[model samples]
Target: MGLSAFQMVYWKACHLPVEMKHKALWALKFLNFDPHETQTKRRNQLLELEEMQLHAYDSSRSYKEKVKLYHDRKLVKIVFNLRQQVLLFNSRLKLFPRKLKSKWLGPFGIKRVFPNGAVELENPNDDGQQQSWVVNGERLKHYLGGEVERFSKVMMLVDP
Candidate 1:
């Protein structure tokens, strides 16, 4: 039993963070994938997915296929949204919302500012964000502390 299709999905699902787990947990609802199948079967399903012509994959029986087909077709624009949301859970900045506010509120004076500090706002692209960008504040470096290589207490943005 190398790996059942559902098992493979289960394995991946196990590694998935909360959002993806939610998506994978009830995967059968939105997508036609079985999170508890064998790998060989899953691989076969992926082959069938190749025939769906990307856009039409939603009509397929496996959500896994839709994801794979979308990847195969380079239809990043369509599949990225949900996948990106799932990926966000795995980001290091999971503490912050999709958007954030930054300030030199730390005790440090000012050394140098990171690229993100310069933009008004930039998307962290937590996951599959195709157009990830960041929003930064101007003159943020002026408030940095000299000994501070990094500061965790900077102003952060949160989703309402």
Candidate 2:
């Protein structure tokens, strides 16, 4: 005579008397008991739960990767060549500044371009003053001036 799984669990939880524990084994003998089948069913259920958890984790990771790719695609690429004039975004400007003030501060000429995204800027008005700044390309944009259109010479006769 052997104890059924449920009786064994109850006996372990309550710490029943030795005589009471022995009586449950007599009841188990009256009913057919299969320990191998019960253990196999529990193992199968654990494997199923583990597989479901792994699938959920994979789906969550893939969704995050797709969202990141979408955001990356929407970003505009900014590149500055040598001698190109561009406006720099002034991030340090106060929240309540003058109404007439502009946040973008420079029409500075790009004196030199570095491979690692650093640019050397020179003010055309100042003869010898130049500043070297290591900044991301996102903080700059191309500057179009009316001086280029106004100063261009129109020649009627061409010498080929």
Candidate 3:
């Protein structure tokens, strides 16, 4: 009978009857057992599992970086220089506004440019009072005021 190291140790620890103790020791002597081989196999398996986890993490990180680059490319680059006149978007205006109301608020002049995309705007009506505000570049656009033809409503006389 072949006995493993653990089985042999367990038999030794337990107080077996006198007749069975000799037979158990004799069986253990003929068995081929290597504890170091079992330990090395377990260590190798753990190392392989760790390598697989690292590879999965790297692949996920690279995919996220690619998506970020794609989104960053779609963003519009609108930069304004100092003293440039730009119209501010009236975001506060509601969907149902007054009939003759315009969506844009200003032809505000850019007073200064911050390191970020924010610009300090100055009112054109220089009333000796310096009232300026910093706003994001996305809220402003270049003012294009030109001779636009206005369309007037014409009533037609129809006989029923």
What would the C-alpha RMSD of candidate 1 be, to one decimal place?
25.6
lDDT of 3 by residue, 67-151 (tens): 9999999988987999888877665446556766666666667999898888887763334565577778788888777432221
Candidate closest to the true structure, highest TM-score:
2
Per-model TM-score versus the true fold: 0.14, 0.58, 0.53
lDDT of 1 by residue, 30-127 (tens): 67655566567988888878866675665665878778888889733222111112111112354554454332222222222244433322233336
**CA RMSD of each candidate after superposition:** 25.6, 13.4, 14.5
Cα lDDT for residue 87, candidate 1 = 12
Checking candidate 3 for backbone clashes, the offending pairs are none
lDDT of each: 0.40, 0.66, 0.70
- Between the candidate structures 1 and 2, which one is better when assessed by lDDT? 2
Considering TM-score, where higher is better, how would the candidates rank from best to worst?
2, 3, 1
